[model samples]
Target: MLGTATDAYQPVERRLGITRRIVEVLAETGHPFSVVTKSAGIERELDLIAPMAAQGLVSVYLSVTTLDNELARILEPRAAAPARRLRAIRALAEAGVPVGVSVSPIIPFINEPELERIVEAAVAAGASSAFSIPLRLPWEVNPLFQDWLQRHFPDRAERVMARLRDMRGGQDNDARFGTRMTGEGVWAELLRARLHRVARKHGLRTERRPVELALFQRPSKPSAQGSLF
Candidate 1:
């Protein structure tokens, strides 16, 4: 919930300790929350997170798209390296925090080939759950992705887009509520099946563990008056 839709641990937020401050407030208020991030920076909050995790109030998911260092560097230049993410998973799990992996935006002929490998690596590093979403190129992202694809994978750029279209019902993206997150058609079904099998084999759940809401305590309002010396 923290970083899947929008990364709260972005470079600037991390540098300013914004995300950490948020976590501090959550911890103080006993509010349960989940963190999804591709940054290894989450490790820095283990002191606060570990205790909450002990009460089933928190969980973490690390997004890892590929295991190949070179490919990862080019694809997610700003994110942490694949190996470092695995380490983060291990660190979280060892501290008794329930951790998972999100192999999101699975691009065909690109990171898709390494889906199982990425999950396996995460499991080995102590991940207990996993999930993924196919790549979606909506609006401006479609052209931008195409341009990048042509530049980096000119040889298979067309093929890749063609296959994605196959999954998206002949379009670059399907914005339908039911089908948007999980695409339709043969290719999408195949991806779903593959992920299910691998997740089962690794004893990893395909869904995130639910956090406890019963422990939530409403944060008290701050005083209107300034402190007097």
Candidate 2:
């Protein structure tokens, strides 16, 4: 409510709107569960954009950090905006707005080198929690990602695929419920190890910060005399 979101940022919010609709509809249908999904989109202009949470409105920014190869993955140039995003998150933090930084799509080979930098940037920006999701390709995303590798960096594309296959259990993706977010076997172990090492070194906890749960007050009823009349 304190900043202006430009045209480019609006469409990014629209992408998250799909999830918002699902949450609203599920609540209307007696789903009996409270769903709160946050922190994704074109994070370049995240500060300018704010979505209402249970309390007032706040902005949730997630950095995807997509890369071509495992090496490129580590050096994945800071996406869309380097300074504005940081400034916004810092400003919001000082304003007492809850903030979370997501180093998402932590794909197999590439997501290693920049891990510490990412965490440091987030901490410097006043992020309260750190979360990450591994790379996944349900349908065409796998092939599209592979081809993107071929087009951009043919030199090491084959090695990248090999490492991905190792983590993915000899496949491009493993869609099973338990293994979807994390790959399988030895390579997956290494990926997890590196992440843990970097996370600990930077003092970045994996859990999100706690929100206040004592703010609910029921709607007031009419006074007794008014009700009687």
Candidate 3:
């Protein structure tokens, strides 16, 4: 659907009202779509989404990096607090909208220890599924994140990079098709196993069903009528 490296509901969305209009159109067109957001601002548009969820045309996935307030602040300074994200998840689920949690860009030593806690918290907050990915530092992101890591976590920054390199086959990034998202080597394997175990323990969906393409339809373009010779 709509979610693919872009967040539909950003802070500016509150003012621009663009995403709201987009959601309304999706609802009217009966097109299934998903939104991934880091803010509770999405709550403002849930009224438009709830009815769509009844038709399985909408789903919301909130990204939470960590539950620790201190770490969360540093990790996502402008994002909604971890607690607020959970509340939004609960509210959406209460409204009969399918809700999911994404503990994305899971840093190795920083927030990896909180994996189980994060997933459990989402489950308690009514998430139907959960997923995560190891941090991938690419191009400029690599240097920027490294700088931040050094500034904030000087002691453990090198260790974190080392772990990432091991996962990436001795480099900062591994961009291969299958290995990029999950990475490789021991740590990556363990991470996958742990993810599966935790998801199973809480009865969350580990494998998502492919989107039903049949639900999508495009209005036919009108023909130039009466094109007489």
Candidate 4:
């Protein structure tokens, strides 16, 4: 819940403890929530989360883009190693937590080839569900990713961009709600089909868990007098 667009437990969290406190608060309040992160440090918060999981109030999604460690380092220099994330998944699953593996930003040609293998690894590590989305390049991200591709993968950079454009309908991006995450076109449809096939083959779920609205209690705001009518 706390981590969606950005990582909740980045390296700074180890020193700051802000995300841990947020998880602790969520556990205390009995709010059903989910967290998505690319950090192994999330394991440090299992003490707060496992009990919440018992109430169906917590789920975790570990973002793993590629199985190749070298590629992972280049892709996310600050993120935890792939093996460590897998270990975290196993640990959370063993502790009675419902874990999901998020194979996000599935870069065409670069990491897309590992879709099935990544799902298999997640399932093997005890994940109960899996999900993925193809890579999208917005304004700034578009140029940056392009530069990176050119620098690192000169031979296939253009081809990769072409494939992405094919998915994005000859543009750098598709902002439509239904097609934004998965794109649109023949390649996009094929990518979605493959992801679904892999998830089904591995017995990983994509359904939403029922929300327990009864357990939600709005937190009280602090006041100068510490009391209010």
Candidate 5:
């Protein structure tokens, strides 16, 4: 995810190039693939994606976050980059850029309020769809997130951790395929339901439209170039 994408790169274009290469590989895998342009600002993103978008390209734009600290804004995210993520939507739409929104790391009691606002902004920006994942704290993310919570949200920190444990089958994570991306428990089910309700209210469908590959015919054998040995 690119928060200070344009702001903190030795050669920012190179960063996008690296990301594009990975996307190209996934696109060739013969499976339905998804691409999320992890970016903070839509303005800089346009300079990166406008040329990459062909007549019909499938992609999503997920404005990501992991902290609720205002101090971190100064150190990163940069106060100059307006907090309005819909700007990313509008710019991409104006350029005919296919788009959607991803509101991830939906930390409990922290950025949950962002859920509705993010959906509303995407709809207003002409987004065709939307998706979400509750806060996933795997690897060092759990401890790191806990530290962030204690620092920025000390009073409600205990409640947050409690809810997380409940969702994880009494663990921080269940570490299973179906249960990994989404934790398991009453609260987890509620979160998933809430996301669906909001998404439906906003006209964002989670069911992706199937791609029509019947039109993809192999190019006529290059006419053999009519070449002789």
Candidate 6:
């Protein structure tokens, strides 16, 4: 998988073409892979991806945090706009790629309110699956995110942190394996239930699509060259 925990299609990748090269190699080798990103820039690879997708060799997930343009700008300033991402979802789905939507890092009282709406919009744009994760403030991100909240959402910053702590066992962050991804409190349970309900209502799968590993071909080793004495 690509861009599952870290985005492979960042803006810099456009100029570097590293992700593109990786996709080319995977396509050439008939390896099945999945990608997740918030950038519509992935559309640039449709030529290679669309073909692999035809053989069920590739799938893509677009992460749409919020639909409000202003909120999206402040939240994910560098990523593609919500509308552009929806367009990319449509394009990928139209090309037969198994496209999904991730309304992730759900910040309570922020973008959380739009969970249902975002899933509904993505479904309308051809997404076949959906998933979400509550906001995680790991390591130094805890303080940094708090500062950000104080700056951008001063009026509700305290409330936001208070609710987040309630979900994090009265702490700023929890790094436990199982509970890290999905919080363990009543709020977290409610978030999970809400997502599951909405996903079912829209006929979207909440689980990820399994990639076909049997199709992966091991690349041949390069022949050793004789050294010139």
- Best candidate according to TM-score: 1
TM-score of each model, paired residue for residue? 0.94, 0.62, 0.91, 0.93, 0.70, 0.94
- Candidate of highest lDDT: 1
- When 1 and 2 are scored with TM-score, the better candidate is 1
- Backbone clash count, each prediction separately: 0, 2, 0, 1, 0, 0
Candidate 1 Cα deviation (angstroms), residue 141: 1.3
lDDT of 6: 0.90
lDDT at residue 221 of model 4 (Cα atoms): 61
Q: Write the per-residue lDDT of candidate 6 for residues 1-229, one digit (tens) a residue.
A: 8997689987788789999998988987789998989999888999999988888888899999999999988888988999999999999999888999999989999999999999999999999999998999998898889888988999999889998999999998899999998998899999999999999998999998887677776555422541321
Q: On residues 141-186, what C-alpha lDDT tens digit does candidate 1 reach at each position?
A: 9999999899889999999999999999999999999999999999
Task: List model 2 lDDT by residue over 50-100, tens digit each.
Answer: 232334333344453432334433344323444445665576566555665
Checking candidate 3 for backbone clashes, the offending pairs are none
* Residue 27 in model 2: lDDT: 28
Candidate 2, residue 228: lDDT: 73
Q: At residue 169, give the lDDT of candidate 5.
A: 84
Sort by TM-score, best first: 1, 6, 4, 3, 5, 2
Quantify all predictions' global Cα lDDT against the true fold. Answer: 0.91, 0.54, 0.85, 0.87, 0.59, 0.90
Q: Write the per-residue lDDT of candidate 5 for residues 49-80, one digit (tens) a residue.
A: 45445424344455434223463373234432
Model 2, residue 100: distance off in Å is: 2.4
lDDT digits (tens) for residues 1-229 of candidate 4: 6677789987889999998888876776777888889988888988888888888888899998999999998899888899999999999999998999999989899999999899899999999898888898987899999999998889999999999999998998888888888788899888888888998888878764454556866556634563554
Q: Give the range of the ten consecutive residues with the poorest summed lDDT in model 1.
A: 220-229
**Which scores higher on TM-score, 3 or 4?**
4
